[model samples]
Target: MPNTTDIELRGVSFAYEGVPVLEDVNLSIRSRELICVVGPNGGGKTTLLKLILGLLRPDRGEVRLFGGPPRRGRLRVGYMPQYGRYDPQFPVTVTDVVLLGRLGRGGLAGRFAFYRAADRKAARDALALLGMDAAARRPFAALSAGQRQRVLIARALCCQPDLLLLDEPTANVDTVIEARLFEILRELNRRMTIVVVTHDLGFVSQWVQTAVCVNRTVVVHPTSALDGNAIRDLYGDEVRMVRHHDFLSKGGHDDE
Candidate 1:
């Protein structure tokens, strides 16, 4: 079911200086759904997510989130970017990093320091929810790739957002860990709307209920089901999937 309460973008276009990145893209994201945006490199995937996040305004069309602009009610959004590298000697603990998510709610200028009991409780609870309680005091520099990824998600969850946006959530993790991350996202989707941008064909077919493709142009497939034709339409006939099964398998998986 499409979420009745969600975001809608009509004829949206964005450009950097005079060069266009996204051209008249139309999209709608429903509440309580998981949508994946996929495309080749330089395909404006990141640009589109930035538009949803309201970090950049569209050059031509309108974007509405929850009945209004993304900027007006951004606190309800949580975002986790592609895996980030950290300095080994940064000296920040996992708990400290997760606590950063509360900065928005806690206010700025020393406001977070005077945390109410509820705020502290929320941060701790978020860490536990992501299974990071055991490493709450561990230095972020020392955590493994998968553990760090979970911490980033925990940081995002601390906001208790109605919508969560992740860019390349499995970019650096191994396949086993990537599968686990997808499962975690499936569970998360039951509680919040999720929008992910990736080139991973495998995850898209297995997890997403909707697909959005951007390549200077954007197309949205609202139906959860997809076929080889749809895949080829977006990625051309060159991009290949690991497994030899299409989302609507019966037909052998091939980009063409």
Candidate 2:
């Protein structure tokens, strides 16, 4: 499955309560690909992710993942939403927060019983991957924004997914944090496909060859092919590119 098609969308159109959002969109994401989903506000970027996740039904056309319906294929996917719905006052520990991810695989009964040793190990491994293992006992609400983001991403990884979806993982983080986030993403991309939804047009990770632009419709363009016209089409003429280096590193991927 190293080079197999992981996600496919064909002639897909979606409307929310009769308001047109995306129309006639076609896309394919291959295994182990690192993709950035970029577009202007209200351009249906989030909507596109929802469609692929099977959270929303398309008005027309087909959406497929791993050659099947998203609901089935999604078990292999890890998702980090644009927003963390947790109340800041909620006193959940970092490890507890991550264990929530295991619910999908652990079943509702596991929620009442103690987590299995395997589940605990998975949670620990996920925390270690994000370099937050040291803070596993910390309160979730007490962590900084960047730290919280990483913890959420760790939760996503707790599912041990083959496809990872992150929505604005760098939204409010500083450039340093953003850089670090991408560094982790670079590492994660090796055995799994990654889809990042970001507004950062300057996001030029060397390994990210494709930027899927969604603006009512969808367009796939090479990062190098994104010039002013493409920027204008995606963001309505409000952007400037800032280059960043030192993201990719040589390594073997998690192809298993």
Candidate 3:
């Protein structure tokens, strides 16, 4: 088994400009679990992520990681942001980007050194795991969208994190690439806990064992067993759930 439950949000609340985004949010994620968070566009999904990363503080209650504060929790967490936006002119190569993940474990000066042989090996191994070893020496700007995403994930994995947090790991990819990405995620989750925020509810139900549905308030489901009424209540009419009978009659596939 893994260490402690890797994450906990204790009655957390957050607001901006006097308007609340998350209220009375309480959640606990155990080690080696794969959880998917789903809701409408502005349902505080990202806000919850920020709270767990300590990028934002809760207005009312505490957020803890490994039984401590989030900043102190950094050593155990690996975070993959929704978008990778470095400039093409930037001089970093894929190796350099992945090596950045080692900084937390190796100290601030680790990036400048040749890096310990073990650390370099760890970075290379992470790349291989993500199937991005060929692009390891390529300039980060030269890779395609899916390749870039895999590299970012490789970078996060280089941290040897116990808990990995991802925001829209499949956001802009086509269907085929998204399927491949989730396959990788399943393998990763066997060793590390994963918490991802995504709008693609169907994509996660295929693999995730837990669901966190958030709006102003948050609810937890054992699986992605959300019904039409629950979907309507969470996202309103503009994003209602599809009816199974109607969808089947129309020959609509579940993967759509």
Candidate 4:
């Protein structure tokens, strides 16, 4: 039996003010698959994500989520953006932040209703999944960069989404935490489909099953088929490929 596809884009094209950002792109994401999307900065990576999120309408083609219009299935999707800025003195606790995920289902009424006991339980459960339950009462601003990222991920999980999307998840963390984050994501993939937009290729070998390379157009490759030449072809001459072992040891520790 074939795997069910959670997302599909067919001949999709998008442009900003008549300047094309993505053209004739086609891709499909299978349920429970972990996919990494890599591309040069400003090479339509974010644009493609927006299309999948149904935040942007295509100039020419189609995008489908769970075999329907993307927006129709939005509740089943969770998204984490590249940069989320929070004031250091902001008075939000980790649990409070995770509970925001419930807004999608409850909307304004739920907030007015105030979080029910079940909602609080779900938020705490999500935090536990990321090993962040202990920090539930801590201020969001006091956590380390990695901790904050994990909390945001927990917030996404609070939605109980079938599909999760993250952009540059490891951008600000140290190598150890970066490795740990991927380990967490690998575990999450067993239950939910995940699409990550990242420049790092190290995780490709051990975690991601597929890679989507985006430029003006998009191409998908099995993780095993990715190589130095293929990466160079996608990223051009300025790019370099370092073996996974060069940075990560056999025990999965950063060699630094």
TM-score of each model, paired residue for residue: 0.81, 0.83, 0.83, 0.83
Q: How many residue pairs clash per model?
A: 0, 0, 0, 0
| Model 3 alpha-carbon miss at residue 9, Å | 1.1
- Candidate 4, residues 1-256, lDDT tens digits: the string is 1299999999999999998989999998989989998766656888998998899999999999998999998889888775457777889999988999888566665848688787899999988877899999999989987788888888888888999998888777777777877888888888899998887765454577888877678878876666767655645521421232223324422322
Most accurate candidate by TM-score:
2
Candidate 4 TM-score over all chains jointly: 0.83
Put down candidate 2 lDDT per residue, 1-256, tens digits, no spaces: 7889998999999998998889999999999988998765666888999999999989999999989999988889898886457799988999999998787664666757678888999999998977899999999999987788888899999988999999888877888767777888888888789999887866554447688877677878866766656645545433211111111212211210
- Residue 69 accuracy (lDDT) in model 1: 91
Lowest summed lDDT across 10 adjacent residues in model 2 is found at 240-249
Query: Which pairs clash inside model 2?
Result: none
lDDT of 3 by residue, 1-256 (tens): 6756788998899999798889999999988998988866556888898899899999999999888999998778888886556677789899998888888555555646667777789889989987889888899889887777778888888998988888877777788877777788889898889998887876557778888877668888765445546544544422442342234346433333
lDDT of each: 0.76, 0.81, 0.79, 0.81
RMSD of 1: 6.6
Residue 207 error for model 3, in Å? 0.2
Worst 10 residues of 3 by lDDT: 237-246
- Check candidate 4 and list the clashing pairs: none
Give the alpha carbon lDDT tens digit for every residue of 1-256 in model 1: 3447677889999989998888988887778988888766656888888888899999899988877998976788888866565666898999888777777664463363665666668778988876789998999989987788778888888878888888777666678877777788888898889988776865557677788866678777655336667655544532432122243244433432
